[model samples]
Target: MAPPTTTNSWQHPSPHLTRVDAFRRQVNRRYGLSLETYHELLRWSVTELEAFCRELWTFCGVVCSAPPERVAGPDDGALDRMWPRPNWFPGARLNFTENMLAAGLAAHPDAVAVSACREGGAAWRHLTWARLRDETARYAAALRSLGVGQGDRVAVVTTNSVEALLVLLACGSVGAIMSSTASDMGAKGILERYLQIRPKVLFVESRVVYNGKTHDHREKLGGVVAQLRKAVAELEVVIDVSGSSWSDGRIKSLDNFLDVRTESLRFAQVPFDHPIYILYSSGTTGPPKCIVHGGGSALLQQKKDFILGFDLGPDSTYYQYTTTGWMMWNYLISALSLGARIVLYDGSPLYPSPDYQVQLLQEQGVTHYGTSPKFLAALKQAGIKNMPPLDSLQMTLSTGAPLSAEIFEWFRSIFPSKVGLVSATGGTDLVAGIIGGSPLLPVHHGELPAPSLGMAVEIWDANGKNIEDTGEKGDLVITKPFFSMPITFWGEGGEEKYRKAYFDTFPGVWHHGDFVRKIVKTQGYEVLGRSDGVLNPGGVRFGAAELYGIVDQFSEVQDCIAVGQRRKLDADEQVLLFLKVKTPPLSDGLRDRIRTTIRKQLSSRHVPAHILEVQDIPYTMNGKRIENLVKDVVCGRTAKVGGTAANPESLEEYEKFVDLPLVQSSAKL
Candidate 1:
């Protein structure tokens, strides 16, 4: 890999004092070996997988009713034992909610466990650990009275509020699996997912506040519950969180749903692989797939990432801006395992003021902040400047999409010099980060610091040969399974569908679908883009991120999406680049400059055949550009524009480009 430029390197202020360094010392003393560097520790983690997991389990203080006899699977083979679906800590018994509550209460029962607020609402409402435990106890008792028990599914459609967190914990306390989606999602999208799981109880928010609007979902909720009751005979109860009166007699308000007669909490100690969460695949191109995750694996892996990777502790305050729809919400919830205070916001960060989130960071004294590249770019676009130092903010993590080098510099330019900017990559498939930050590593521009420990991450060519050392872009694959792999998919033929989705691409290895390369010099990785959406024009393949990074430098472009288009009758694929500009009428001068910069920075092959301007770019609910969906539209294919899209109507504008004269001429026989 080429060396990081002088401007690209951001050195860590204090490496030795980091939690990873402290862990390294513990590892050295216990293992009777000297592993000096972060890279060396990472190597030992993947190679001695069992030892590393055992160490991590003890270090994180995982609260369990019964400890496992061994850290590896029961078959005594950590690798090649049923391959991808193998279990970890086979004989262990634990309760997910118990662990989180224990850690929180152990720190201090009176401390704030959650601080939540809404857009255009009153000041933050703090929920102490004692109050959180009480709420969970009451909810669990109510669930039990409703016949919810071990293995039952409880679904929630709510905002990122204290009530949602309480419902999740209550479900975990009873060993009932929990699945949730944000209230902003249309009823159809919500039904499509909940229908597959057939949850026993449903929790729906009556009102939602977003983008400076209060959306009342009374009619929508009635229609959804009516449909769900008809289809799912097992779905017996509906609870309204916002206390709005509903016409359906089956719906009960939060005050009415709770069992006032009961007060104590009882945690169900189930097996190690007991299912706790059911997440869905982003169904941009098709129906969303339901993925089930286990309690033990989710607890161990996420705690490792939060405590070790981000160096979070009991005194730290973590604020991850997310909705219930995204996996980051689950990751954020896991912060409680460290007894750390967490901030939960339900509406747009841009509302009230442009720098509202920055102000929250300073006010909350957040030690770790989780966000995306889009928000940072918006700050720069809004001309936000001269931010005072936040002495409490230690690290800022960006993950929804790839963070550009310019954004990295922009973060450095705005934040305090001591704050480390982490550009990490992971997805919903695992419900955790595969490659993220480490306090011991330097922040290189446009690169993630390292692969998460015990992930066994590597880059593989089309033939499944490891090419990570070659410094060549390839598929990001996991040669060995880690703790957080999904336990199973939720319904009929689910296992087959799951296998086909991930393992079918490369047989046994976990194909993560990201196009990336290893920066050998810095021991970091540059995530190019999704491998499936790679653009191939003239038989030369490259990631759209390469083109986007250059085009983003242009002041005229506000947002963009690059995709390859090939009609059914066409022999060759052509590249189409769409731009959303700040000003109207994209001038020829700006287009020529964009093309010139792309051609100069990248090869001519990387340049798009058509540079068109559009009013908006389609994005998923999670803030990812819908490139594949756009590709389908421009190629004249019928696309399934589902509720996963944040703005599905934006797809209509791309249909006009199907029969462009240049594109028609470029199509070879």
Candidate 2:
């Protein structure tokens, strides 16, 4: 296989002025060595992992009460082999909230820390650093008054708004573990997650507006609280952020619940390994796993990512289009720790117009914007060209799904050439990116430029052999331990379960479950798709993203899903491609054109046995294609549609294809 010959699109104007470059100089001074290039720094970072973490903590300006006893504890050979889990920063005492708010409050109390807005391009509401600190104190005092304290769990079913972030910080201030999901999730979905942790206090929104529709969720909230109380014996209070009536005795309105008199803020210092947040896995196929994260590691990793990975500083304004449920929300708010203002937006990005987000970015003077590939696809399909010249924009990031080559080229055509487009790949498992952008490097089209500084990212074959330099697709594995690894999955046998989920595949290394191939010529990596979702048609393995990358070039494709199917009578799995076509519906000519292109570009072995048209495609709430669910339905297995789905009903259309004549005929081969 040959790498594409496309030139790098964007490069830093002054690399020496960037934060990462400054940090590199600081490291060189401390170590008394000269390391010039980014790749050299990367090699040193992974080889001396503990020293790299120590340097990150110092350079990132972490606010701590006590210094760490040691940089990091010794690794027990394999990551899964350790009996007692090793902590990253041993004997350190710090508060996550203090680290997030202290620097901003100290430097400029009057500066805007948060700019909040809702759908329809509403007027932005700004919260200054001083006000945010004061409000967080009051909320923390209120939580203490309600008997919530350190090690206790506080959950929320809320929208992405100012009040929600206030409660999150307040919980962190008092050393309580915070867990949250989006308001759009149904009662069953929310309960499925919250019931596992059994939080002492639950905060929920009364109403949510999206796509210009206001939905009153009072009835649903009442039912959810009722069921929650029955199962969760620790449940004590349910506070509604929005002003809404509640008949339940445990429920309290926000105004009544808040303690307004207290104005002084205090941060409870906990050990380095103390739990800060509990995030859940997508429950598409089964029950969601409750993953707990440590404060010190989360803070260090996020700060490193922001300061070095994206070159964010105090002057930068950051906005990430996300919901409360996604990890990007947590990632977005971390910008405040660097004295940068973060935008908290609620509701749909497409409301009113497709270009509303661009208008908001222009109005707010956002330098760094984080978004998903789905949003870019929407803008492309809507024919949004002639975009206003966004002079203030510096970088645009894409995650949540693979950024196809076509979308990458289209994005370059629309946005300013000076604005770098970064395609990053990571997971909610780690609250930071594994392979993300570098300020010193040039931005390449459709490829992740570099591995995250502290992450030892590599590709491995089925035999556990390192295949990164071969340009052949393999499983993405972390060969060493990093700070941001989750503390543990929350439950009995959590350590064992965590090991099984990440380490069982390779017996030592952390198998990230992503199929990837490193581009040998450019040293950039391309995420193919989920390793578990890899298509194995007639014993040839490949990711669905490879097929989508080719099919997406066609203007007729609105959306598509490719999966491998095998029935009880079939001899081998056959590849099936389902297309959600735009107006002229998928004609035989168009199908032949797609098939011919796939056979020509990729080999004949890569072509799908059938190209069927569908009315719609299913996606998760985070705008990811639910390939596993579709594969399950088409294989004649019952699909256990979970709460993570944005549109589960769209899956019913795929049920008829279970007994496809073409699939049955493949068995005769």
Candidate 3:
């Protein structure tokens, strides 16, 4: 049997929606519907939206084609086939990293560019628009000599440093494929991703600076290098940034690698669809899919999210808590396109103390910030105080999973009322957000501003048909293929897997696999919990947020996970509720009350038949709950759990729980 159903102890459908106007109508018209879904940024003509996109593309040198609305079989008529084929800037050429680098340095040259601090009381490093550009050029010249030519792959096992940015942009300047894994990941984890790409040159740090201390990365990195040597025949140059001692045949200090380069070298330019970076999926669904992004598509999407979505500009200074392995690090680095400073941190946001990152924000007066809800939740739990006043901040962005309203309100409460949360959403595949907050839109407590300017986002029923009911829950689907869609799966030719992953579920549409709702709730705006992660028992459904609210309210329950456990004998599976709390000889009355409260609040059907206690809940290395991963584990599947994911040992406890006698009794429930 799989687990039973349980919702959060705090969430429910909110009825607070604002009055609608022409803006709402215009929003629907552009995205393929005129439904009264609540949210700001609904007002504006499709022309206005198109105008926004065109300026953005021109500004960032991103090439785009029309949305994927008009795809036809290969043999379709000329106008129909060729017209809708791929509308990118077919005749134009540009560099992917150039756009991001240009944004912060070249185009908008006078921006307050970057400020970085490694650990407690470390010397701060700041870079202006002009300085960052020159550094990138130096690195570009350096990498070009290492044979990082167009179409070649360069991988990095490193930390968050300016050199990392230099390397990414340098590779882009010459059209080399860029791949990176964060420093903390185990050697095996780094090898898994790198082996797939079979990179020609690797840039690795001998060590990493974190939490005011240095860790010897070489111990694990050496193992990784030896493995790569066995798998890839072409892997040659190894650029060591640690300045550590090494005499391997292929290894050389980055200093010497860059020493042979000249000052006046030319940067390589490529066609719009040229591959520039390789990013893997979250692997919650299955094996990580290696999605290859083109220079043009990445530039457009990154520019759209950073510039218009976050209201970034020459005056903007952006901060996002992220790393090389996670997509946000890639997304955050694109703020360079806005000609804004990029704040990159290598330590925990709450390191040395609960207010670690908050101090940085206060010290720097960040203009724009992006982070995850899991990070914010930890801040709340730690009771950190007087976070640097983000008075200079224009917007805050959150992504990775559904950001609860509780978190939204908590963050807003700390800042002024005018401060808005962008509620960003997207992944490594798109290279940025598909939906983000808008400055022009009146702020909503938890909803994203609107669908991305040119993206055709829709809520679809199980059959892949559009759902008209405002509050009806459905799968999030794209009626048209947006420009940011992956060109093709990396290491594979053509679009077979691309089509299979996004289009096979539906005949013509792209399925995003998120059970979600696009709605204009109580205030004409709402960002709801994931519907795909819903808990259903006997066909009665409840979202994770809804169940979490009820069970977690128990003082004894520190944290919990709610999942629908499939039963072999019964058509309707049971709701398996796992609670992670302090073990105790607590009152049985308290446990009874917890279950009773859920039955009363949701329904008897919503109550989990079996509520088992565990020592801790498993979370990805990033701190978010690993729902599907744990779900896969309970079902006896072998998953390549990544090294970067945190506290994997907690997952082992969950595995051990199955042997406990309590599980059999819960099974009958």
Clashes of each: 0, 0, 46
Q: What is the TM-score of each candidate against the true structure?
A: 0.97, 0.96, 0.84
lDDT of 3 by residue, 117-195 (tens): 6765375787776777777788888877666799899998777777788888888888888888788876756776777
**Better candidate number, 1 or 3, judged by TM-score:** 1
Clashes of 3: 46
RMSD of 2: 2.8
- Model 3's TM-score against the true structure: 0.84
For candidate 1, the per-residue lDDT at 265 reads 94
Report the lDDT tens digits of candidate 2 across residue range 3-44. Answer: 222444567667788888888888899999799979989988
Error of 2 at 539 (Å): 1.7
Write down the lDDT of every candidate, Cα atoms only.
0.86, 0.86, 0.64
lDDT of 1 by residue, 1-669 (tens): 222224566666777877788889999999998998888999999888878988998888988878987876657776543355776886788999998889889879999999998874455799999999988999999999988999999999999998899989999999999999989888778888998999999999988878888889888878888899999999988999998877677788899998467869999999878999999999776568999999888988889898778999899999999999999999999899899999998898788765888888888889999999888888878866557578899889998998988888877777776788899998899889999888777779899989888888989988889999989889999887788888889999999988987898888888989999998888789898999898877777778888878876877788999999999877778899999999979999999998888878876777788999999999998899999899999999888877689899999999999986444322222
Instruction: Give the winner by lDDT: 1 or 3.
Output: 1
